[model samples]
Target: MSSTNRRDFLRASAAAALSAAVPADLFAQSETAQSSPGAIWDSGSVRHLLPTVSDSRMLIKVSFTAPVEGEPRLHVGDLTVRGSMGDTRGEHWHFYATDLGPGRRYPLSLVGSNGRALCQPWELATFPGPDERPNRFRLLIYTCGGGHEVHKFLPTAVRNRLLRRGLSFQPDAMIANGDHVYWDLLAPVGSRLLGAAPEAVKAAGTFDRSAIVLGSDNETVLKRAAGPQIVPVYGTDFRSTPVFFLQDDHDYFDNDEATDEVVTFPPSYFMLQLARATQGIYYPEFLPDSARPLGLPWSSGRDRAWGVSESFGTLRFGRLAEILLYDVRRTQTMAGPSAVYIDPAVEKWLKARTAATEVAHVVHVPSNPPGWTAGKWGEWYPDVLGREGKLTTNEPKPYWQPGWLKQHDRLIEAMAAVKGRAPLVISGDLHAIAIGRMLRSGRLDLKDNPVNVVLSGPLGSRPGPLGWPSGRRGTGAMPSAHLDMEEQVKPIEQHGFTVADFTREKIVLRLFKWDIKTQPVEAIDTLQPFHTAELTRPA
Candidate 1:
């Protein structure tokens, strides 16, 4: 109880406090992380995916701030699947548990290397196998996001209404067809600039916009945003459903403005590297063998100033449907009809799948609709020329430029070759909700086939479709061969998702829409789709 004893106690307390402090390091390695364990990745980085395949399998992955010092295994039901943190994204650890049994639901949690419960478990749902014919299933497609921290960057009520819809019509699986999150800013808030529209920041893929939501150089920031800001929007459904995400221009660069030159792409060198590393941290690709596979993202040789990835591939589901996921941003032609949107490999794969006699349908998931949407930025439409390569405009440099039109026809021809199943093109971009039948007879027609093109997008943005009162956002749509016999049904330009119900016989599509400006969450609780249409196999 003497003054000397009190002094000794104070010294010990001070030493412990110093050792336990967590340093505010962004991406720093540390021996004294107990006080402030530098993040290898942020807490709770769980991502779910249903690998493209006819069979059932689910993939669950988590990114850790640092590699687990010991072992990391995921426990689902009575089965234990070992996970490895050997993968790194700028010192951050990526742990994956893939190819787990499909068709059953299970609660998943982490069992640490040291034999302790590392984190809470989540419920996962896998798909059915190839030989299986899933008469029908609903899939939620999300795309064209506002950005990482929607709260900070804009006042828009960023919401994903389809995710919140309960068990009644909740989707069986989900597809994030790119425009997932925006990360164009290179500096902190104080040193950055922004644009009027989210796209404006790229200033239409020409300007440098700055805003700090996460770190271009730090995995922790991106993980934190994905955990709290991004993940939950899918809500409890994410606990049980599978999600597949593909990258677009935004996921790669700020936004891609398809000028006449592929060599002049804005994001090159370190900027591309930052984008690639950040992307690697968030959406690591996991392709199952059962899903028809193809080569992955690759470099355009020197153009890859950012990252190298193979974002195009295919998945065939039994004899029911085939899913074709292509990277429009990277593969897009440097200029015009012959530019080569389908890398010869991708086209070959598409043609082979189309030729397959078994599959009844093809679900084509492209980043943007094959062409432009009259509802939003119609002039930016690329396929202005008709099937015969006849120009519609007489201007020297018209409002829109030429693009992969020839290749576009090739894509549809391949689709027509898809023996039994009518190709269903589901896409994202142009913050409008429009389901249309392509006008093949028009001068601007896509082709002679009945390929139906649908839009599912703006999971985060303005709540209404582009032209609301009429709700015919897509009636007089761009004439792409893909949507030849098209009719605009309930073209309500609003924030929403499209659910396509598929069976061996037909695929009926329903557009589920929402309004944050009015009902907020109340808008999504509906048994009926805002609009619905049916498509049967061609006779």
Candidate 2:
């Protein structure tokens, strides 16, 4: 059958299954009625499941009702954490539990308004410290472009490949860097989308729309199921793997671009809120109970008016190395139509954290180097401010504005000051794979300073057949780029993820790619290694 026909058939099959699973009473209720408190109790898909921090913590967030109102009480096995209810743009309930540990698992259930079981119990687990005997941590990162659509075959293909590779190949977490769903199809001209829309509108417009556009026939069934099923299936593929989700531009709107007047949108924000409520894989639930309430203090009148304080945080693997995850996108400041600046607070945080830790490695998600370039940082070029309080318009046109340059300089200097501490950067915005070294002086001097930047593309998303032509190192149709290196790291069109194995001797990073299919395909393609060299700090 043609690809379109095959997709249609699959959608029909999924729709039938969803219809059978949903209780008839649910179909009869008005959209508002279905969202009312106690209404979710009737949902087979809706469960009072909370993503736990670790094996010891009792605190958990219960997700069931739509736009979860005032905090609810949570009981996990023998433990309990009283939830402090807040809303992410008055859309979904934001819950928090301050006390929790690392490396543990717990079973959690919810207590309804009447103190009875409202839904089935679910389990959550915490990440282990860096030193904890090298437990396998599977992280799946993917990117979304305007043309790309989520396909059942994509997920199915990923599951099959991992299955063939065995449990060892299963991922511990998943990151949807951005564009989790396409919203340009839903928007008309320039009116912004807010996250605080009624739950029904969100379901019909965003979730259901994405389902149809993505060709998921079970979209309605998945939508009616109450909680999201995609992440659960991926998690279930393994014996309950924890997921860490990150949103990119697509998740918020058609692209990451937002006017200074309006910051957040409804579709992306609503999707995020729902992801949190349902423990969807697209949203990171494995973060410590401490990381709950993840958003900025800013109060813009936008649906997804929430932002992570500083996307940069340290995850210590015992005493091995501190994993610094930076949210480069959120810290940017836009002024007029000319430049963007990184908030001073984030800059201070990055500098201070790097200086304080003796970590052997530093990992950045958006690994594009400082200075502007095409497709990557150039899109936001006007926002980058210069040191002299103006925009930089030097020849070759910097990829970023002045403000961005300052922030980039601060990060690079801080990392360099670490005195030979090997920094490994992993990025996924580009939908292609490559490996290169980051240098302070644009020169490829290995001795002075060296940082490994790995650009790994989509895990399962369809990246059309067109590939970048050879010799066109940094600029091309493919979504991959890296700092100038001795040997140019060319972009490779493939569908898969990258695995970084850090040992005492050296860090081994591997790229794994496969075709989309239910059955496993043999012969996975692997990439060559790029070693990290030792650097010397100035006295």
Candidate 3:
């Protein structure tokens, strides 16, 4: 054959062979994997691995490089958001895939409108489907983002330890029970008052919201390590593993007082606004009016007085389990203790979800402890006090009036009424790990209606009291006396996180403690069953 003809013949033969060797679907994926400059993903700019709603459908979040020039596109299996150029860029954008069942990993690829590949397409996780009874499941629980108790900032080493351990533990979900950010004291003043006398600690701010709320510079007093530092530690890579967030007193400005621009040390309007903005930005949430005319952000709305709203609702992963996340921070007000601590709508929501029959268990997440503590248990948050002429100081002094005490009484009544499932109560704020059976006010047999209280937290660090590296426990009033319960006012000396595993027969809790004296302790010492517990449906 002629030279030109022979070459053409050989090229055609090679092309045909290549096509025959590769699968059509594989070839198509490779073709689309190529990106154009108009659409790119900046992975380093990617943060916040949030699993919003995981069920038959999965809603995942992704953040892009600042000045995100174009819309971000997501591609996974048959799911794609090609024309869905969402309004948010350089910020957060959520997209979902329907018909996705639970308990499996789905491979995904994300690209910004600019064509930057966010991360080499990876597998995103999904919870177990309702019909399937997965033999086991797991979750990690944590609180207190302060690094070294004394350091009180994004302790990089500490965050690394948490990240490493969480990855190693392989929890199906992670619940940041409360106090993810300690914005109680803003900037300069906060630095000076890290662990000042209880009376002097406050939520004072400089009003330049950007500096402390989102900045990772630990030097700033309100440097919310949860944002710049801790979020990165978790990263968008864990998008498959759902992460849930809850707010406590610290997250709401000071320790517990929710505010509308008050004169007290805790609830400054600007600080609340900052917390609202920051909370909405960092976490994945089901906002106030999700079905409004357009997409509304979490914690804010044109309809609200201060553009702030609620973050309490129910999350279910099939019929296996359901969670009720309560908004204790926003529900509070300077309106005296007799006022409502939970929005009526939220309370209604909680009561209804607790009655769901499909789930094997119901978990209640209230930022503050439900059981009573001794004199001045939750003083920092300002829940039981009012801002009227009757009380002058914001400190947790003898400021609690009858009205405040009455409000707490209301909480007790509400807790007493919660039934249907043997409930699991997980709380933070005490800065220690403590667990005991909760007996309702008039019940003696905890076996039938026992309220198991599990305390988990201090992921970063926080000093307990004077001259002590850990917090000294304060005794509190028991919820009920008729039942077998421990009225624990014991001091908690350890600092760490809890990893919980759920099996068909029982749910197990493994408490991992760290050395408060060290930033990132080389080893994670497992505490005994005292910090752990196992439970099954009451017989």
In order, what is each prediction's RMSD in angstroms? Answer: 12.9, 13.5, 11.4
Residue 111 lDDT in candidate 2: 48
Q: How many times do residue backbones clash in model 2? A: 36
lDDT tens readout by residue for model 2, 1-539: 58565434322311111111223132133423211111112222233332323322322233344544444566543656565443232222323344456555545555444454444444455555544644223344444322212222244334334332322333344444443443332232211332223432354443443332112443332343322323332322322343334444444333333343434332344444343333231233333313223332221113221222223333444444345454444444544333334356545655665666444454555523232232433242332223443333332233335455445545655665566466555655555556666554222333355655565555544433322212212343231122334323555555555655444434555565554433234443121213223222233
Runs in model 3 deviating more than 4 A are 1-48, 63-66, 82-104, 129-133, 146-154, 185-205, 208-226, 257-269, 287-310, 334-337, 372-420, 440-448, 463-484, 487-491, 518-520, 525-530
Report the lDDT tens digits of candidate 1 across residue range 196-235: 3353333232322243223432334445333333443432
Best by TM-score: 1
Q: Per-residue lDDT for 178 in model 2?
A: 41
- What is the alpha-carbon RMSD of candidate 2 to the true structure? 13.5
List the candidates' TM-scores in order. Answer: 0.70, 0.59, 0.69
Off by over 4 Å in 2: 1-74, 82-97, 107-124, 128-176, 185-239, 256-313, 335-341, 367-400, 439-446, 463-483, 487-489, 516-539
* True-structure lDDT of candidate 2: 0.39
What TM-score would candidate 3 get against the native?
A: 0.69
